[model samples]
Target: MPDQAERLRELVRHWELRRKQTRRTIAVASGKGGVGKTNLTVNLALALKEEGRSVTLLDADLGLANVDVVLGIPTTYTLAHVTRQEKNWQK
Candidate 1:
């Protein structure tokens, strides 16, 4: 591998170590639509994935969900369909 590739791998390894050592949950919110909120969520999830962290994107819009649309995951089930304990947002 080239020098830059080795450096990137080293950084990824470092991030993986950090991810393993610390687990944190963060909620991203926005008050306006078409304001890049979904984009931010998508990018954040991608970043965490790059860092080897487990990330789940939840639409939480009850009957409507667009995260799957932004991320392009077909909705198999919605919050409306999920019962009390059927699926606790474990995407």
Candidate 2:
């Protein structure tokens, strides 16, 4: 069991190293709403993209999703749709 655990730890460390070399990830979160968390996230993504960094913004706020609205992009699908199998994320 200990050997297996050590192997898992080594695998995790290897993947973590690869992940750091690949790209950066940022998560903007706040316990309170209407505090501009979404706004900041969108702006940060735009700034990163402007600097030639690839950016993919995910609006995880299912209850009060406003990232698309703030960015002036209409959403035909959401995480809920994906969860319900109504839409495929790859599409």
Candidate 3:
């Protein structure tokens, strides 16, 4: 169990290092609903992609998930699946 914990820590550290090496990160957040946070995030991702930038938009709105709907993309899995160990992020 100690070895597994160490491995997980190492993996987290590696990802943190990689994130630090990235060029930019954009986080769209809102304290209230009825705002265009999802739309803005989607549009920003699209604009960044159009400019030839690699963009990974994580729809973390667990309560009201609609980013996939707005983008017309269907998702078979979500963070819940990953948390429940039903799906792997690599997949």
What TM-score does candidate 2 get on C-alpha atoms?
A: 0.70
| Best candidate (score: TM-score) | 2
- The RMSD of every model to the true structure, in order and in angstroms, is 7.0, 8.2, 11.8
What would the per-residue lDDT of candidate 1 be over residues 2-90, giving only the tens digit for each residue? 79989999999999888698867778766666777777888999998997777776666564458888877777777765665676565
The 10-residue segment with the lowest total lDDT in model 1: 56-65
Q: For model 2, how does the per-residue alpha-carbon lDDT over 1-85 read when each residue is reduced to its tens digit?
A: 4798899999999997786579767899889988989889998999988977778888887788888889998998888998899
Candidate 3 backbone clash number:
0
Candidate 3 per-residue C-alpha lDDT over 1-91 given as tens digits, one digit per residue, 9 for 90 to 100: 4788899999999998897568886888889996999889999999989977788888877778888899898988887888899998776
Give each model a TM-score: 0.63, 0.70, 0.69
For TM-score, candidate 1 versus 2, the one ahead is 2
lDDT of each: 0.76, 0.86, 0.85
The C-alpha local distance difference test score for the whole of candidate 3 amounts to 0.85
Give the higher-lDDT candidate: 1 or 2: 2
After superposition, the stretches of candidate 3 with alpha carbons farther than 4 Å from their true spots are: 1-23
Q: List clashing residue pairs in candidate 2.
A: none
